[model samples]
Target: MEAGPRVLIVEDDARLAAMLRELLQSEGYEVSLAPDGQRGLHLGLTESFDVAVLDRGLPVIDGLDLLTKLRERGVLVPVLVLSALGNAADRVEGLDRGAEDYLAKPFDIDELLARLRVLRRRPASTVPVIRFAGGTLDAANRVVTRDDGGRLALSERETALLERLARRPNQVFSREDLLENVFADADDPGIVDTYVHHLRRKLGRELIETVRGIGYRMGAAP
Candidate 1:
């Protein structure tokens, strides 16, 4: 991969996912993992990934179904199917279903890396910074502000976290979810709650809506 491929791995096996994460990270690839196909598909659609490692068998949504949807929606990112089905027919079937490549279980590390390098050869992936609710977020700058010309400082972590939430208004993300997905570490569960509290105080009371007992969600500025 030229600039390093940002890969998304969709696997239900937690241990396998961890091993993949470690291995991919060691290879200098930016990695994101989803425990099920639903989250994986959602991330793939909303976020830009250079390559997606999709398990043929998934719980929430089948891997084939996700590849189909992505292809139907015109998302042409390379997908390398991962499965335990080693038969030649199975591999052929998966590739025919829109997979760029199919790798069976117990594959060698060198081969997996080789396949990822091949996936990255297709193209570079980038995400556009979204604007809504009368404010512009400098995604590259990791900053946000009101359109009224008022300036409020936000730390890098807070700004990045806020940007993720602000991307999809009315999307409720639990504290644990934010901790795991939004932040680099789930070190502080209370940190998300604290960030929400601080963000509300800064952006305005109604900028984010709290769904009692569940999590926090973003909304239009009042």
Candidate 2:
């Protein structure tokens, strides 16, 4: 018999993960489990899957951060974000960060399965590409390709920072905000400045505009 559609579950709770794995397997899904965000990210980046189920609060890397990293690295796998943070803002944030669907904790298993079915059915061609004035960030591969066809590969942190700024062109993000959202594990806020400088040097100084007292925003693409 043909194998079922592959599904990856990145949940930290051992009992919950096991239960989910068994249930999904029984329902004819080929499930893979990751106990923490780090492992989840490794699997997410290196493996192929029809869909993914991710928990919000994870160790090593936060769920949203893992989602963001996956996106920045050009992983187009449809992700369903499962989190206890079901508030309006949280849902919006999850969607913005790359989740195809968001379901709150204590959710119905049937509903979750239904949602997964929906996500699995989504066309891979529907994945959007991130573009700028001078080039496009290839979503299939983690590289910025210029109009002239020159490609520049960015480090994971650089890609994450650039992706965040590029996604919201008009908004200015303060250093503190970037530090909190993008560099969650880092204690020194100056790390933000350091990466910004690295991006500027690699992509071009015009790639990121530093607001005098505010912070930084996406500048003219180069």
Candidate 3:
């Protein structure tokens, strides 16, 4: 059987951590939990995980500091910050520090699950290549090859945006869809259009077609 996606849960609350572990495992994910930022940071650095759900309050290292450390160490794994510190500034801080998404405490399990799915999709794939429009997108290396054999690099968000659209070929993705899958909740949906424009310039306008009143799709205009 294929191995399930690996997940790391960094939470101080024993009961809630257990609950999250149980729920995620039931959904066929491999779940590991840490009760404090120290252990969580250790596991997060030492192991591989598709996603990390981090709680802000912890001993030995707070969530924000742990997250900051992770990024400073160049760990690109998607992180979802979970905390009772629910406020605009808190959310902004979490995002500014490289958390992929943020969920306030007392959040619904269903919402958490949905957010996890989105997080998994946001990262560029480790897979070899996804082809479209006579060019190729290498999610693993964050490179895009033009039909003319020119190559260009991409930022994290650019890679995520391209991967989301290119993986589906001609399927159109709305701004909200891109926002949910490729950006934090605190991000503006307009940022989606901005990245789309960026990808078009790098990959060629024909490689990504704007569906006019809709959103964007992966295909050359015919």
Candidate 4:
């Protein structure tokens, strides 16, 4: 099995920082959090990471300055800049400063993960393959194959959802948790149920165990 990619996230907002940490950790990435740009700069310069996620506004040292200093020190790991400054010029500036990608605040978690995946340039071999009672989920190709060899192609959303569940078999995920990590607030909470149903229809009704009044997990009925 491939090791989890290491990630450094620098954001001053306590709530947002914690949320980002939890979400990334759930995806099996080894994550470290820095609440200020100074600490972030220190980590970026001293330690090695597959990628870094940074916020534009930071205390002690501005995020842009941190990025600038990191580059000045020859740190070349990909950086995904996250900020509330969503203007075109703002994005251009971040890119100019050497961010590999830029994401606006109030962003969807799914998009963030997708961007990080791209930035990491994860090799095909490192993609996780998940196996359960009835089938295998080939994440590299986003296909789920049953023991009999039948395969079900999945949409990106479905693939991410399945991947998360497969990573921790039997671990339940609540609707709110799924909504926060798998979709944006623009998406209705009911969408979680919709996708769960779709997975059931394709993977078998019993493949995903639903916890009444709680959430869903990976498994089958007895």
Candidate 5:
């Protein structure tokens, strides 16, 4: 990738979230920290973190619930569940929900970064770079640069949500699809609406059409 991979660390334990943030940043990643799942969900949906390190035990919502929600929403970003629930059954369930990898507590920072590297290294198919409603969305780069020449400021999550919907512009995607497309941590269903609102603000309300009873879709196919 041409730019640094972005990551979000959602851990209720304040101490740990700080450590992980520093560790990942030192390794050249743009890292965001959320102390609990509630706020984490906000950050996850609004920003595009390449991968997420989620703690299973969280206040507001548990880790498993977060993971399931992410998959249900259609956030295609890879997830690596970071939890102390290392039992065979628990680990199995995490992977089944949507985790690309699982790391138990008391893990080595180096090991976690190594796994993150693997997740980041995986390739995504190249689709024609999409242009619509005045902005150029680089599907492969997962970055959107508006025509105004403003800095490309999309967080990893914002980029994911836009790319998913814009790529299939005319097709509608329900809240579930957006969840899986952006929030890889299984946070909450309501969070889907929040992300859409944020995405709409950035892309311009006219570009993404809202289907009252269904979900949302881009104005027209690119």
Candidate 6:
């Protein structure tokens, strides 16, 4: 017989995780459980799954952070976020970070299963590798390859920020713009400045240019 669709469950609550694993397995899903966000991240980055069910309050890495990292590296597995914080803002934030669906704690088991079915049926998305004068930003792999053949690995946020700038090379993005689009969860807009510094240090100062009193833009390749 063919194997069932693969499912990953990342929840810190051991009993809950085990219950989910058992329930999903009975439903014909091949389930893998991670008791912490760190382990979840490893499994998510290295494994292939039809869908993922992630708890928002995971240890080591928050669910949103894990979701962001998954998307940055081009993991297209549909994710359903499970959180006790089920307010409108929380749901919106989860969706914004790349979750295909959100289910609050105390959720109906039937609803959760229904949502997973929908996510499993959805097609995976593809992100194109961005080319700039200095190098290529492989958003899928989270790597920057210089024209001279040197490659630099980027963290999750770095890849997202660089991909945003590279996608629109001619347009200037204000710090607020980057904050809203790239760092939506960040309270301080200065985080943009910090990541910009990081990228410049690794890729070269000329790779990105700061517009006076405005924001920043993709510069001519170094």
- Candidate 4 local distance difference test against the native: 0.82
Model 6 lDDT on a 0 to 1 scale: 0.89
Clash count, candidate 1: 0
Among all windows of 10 consecutive residues in model 6, the one with the lowest summed lDDT is: 177-186
Candidate 4's error at 178, in angstroms?
A: 47
lDDT of 2 at 53: 94
Q: Could you say which candidate leads in TM-score? A: 6
Give the C-alpha miss distance for residue 69 in model 4, angstroms.
0.2
47-140: candidate 6 lDDT, tens digit per residue: 8999999999999889899898677556789999999999999999999988999999999999999999999888877788799878898887
Cα-based lDDT at residue 91, candidate 3: 97
Ranking the candidates on TM-score from highest down gives 6, 2, 5, 3, 1, 4
Model 4 TM-score on a 0 to 1 scale: 0.54
lDDT of 5 by residue, 53-149 (tens): 8998898868778766554334457788998899999899999887889998889888998999999887742446677666788755666777787
TM-scores for every candidate against the unseen true structure: 0.55, 0.63, 0.57, 0.54, 0.57, 0.66
**Residue 190 local lDDT, model 6:** 91
Clashes of each: 0, 0, 0, 0, 18, 0
Worst 10 residues of 5 by lDDT: 67-76
Positional deviation of residue 146's Cα in model 2 after best superposition, in angstroms:
7.6
Q: For residues 77-174, could you state the per-residue lDDT of candidate 4 as single tens digits?
A: 88999999989999999999988799998899999999999988843223556887788887657798888888889975677678777778869999
The global Cα lDDT (0 to 1) of model 5 is: 0.75
**Residues forming the 10-long window of minimal summed lDDT in candidate 2:** 125-134
Give the whole-model CA lDDT for all candidates, comma-separated. 0.78, 0.86, 0.81, 0.82, 0.75, 0.89
Tell me how far the alpha carbon of residue 199 in candidate 2 is from the true structure, in angstroms, after superposition: 16
Model 4 clash pairs?
none
Off by over 4 Å in 6: 134-222
Q: On TM-score, who's better, 2 or 6?
A: 6
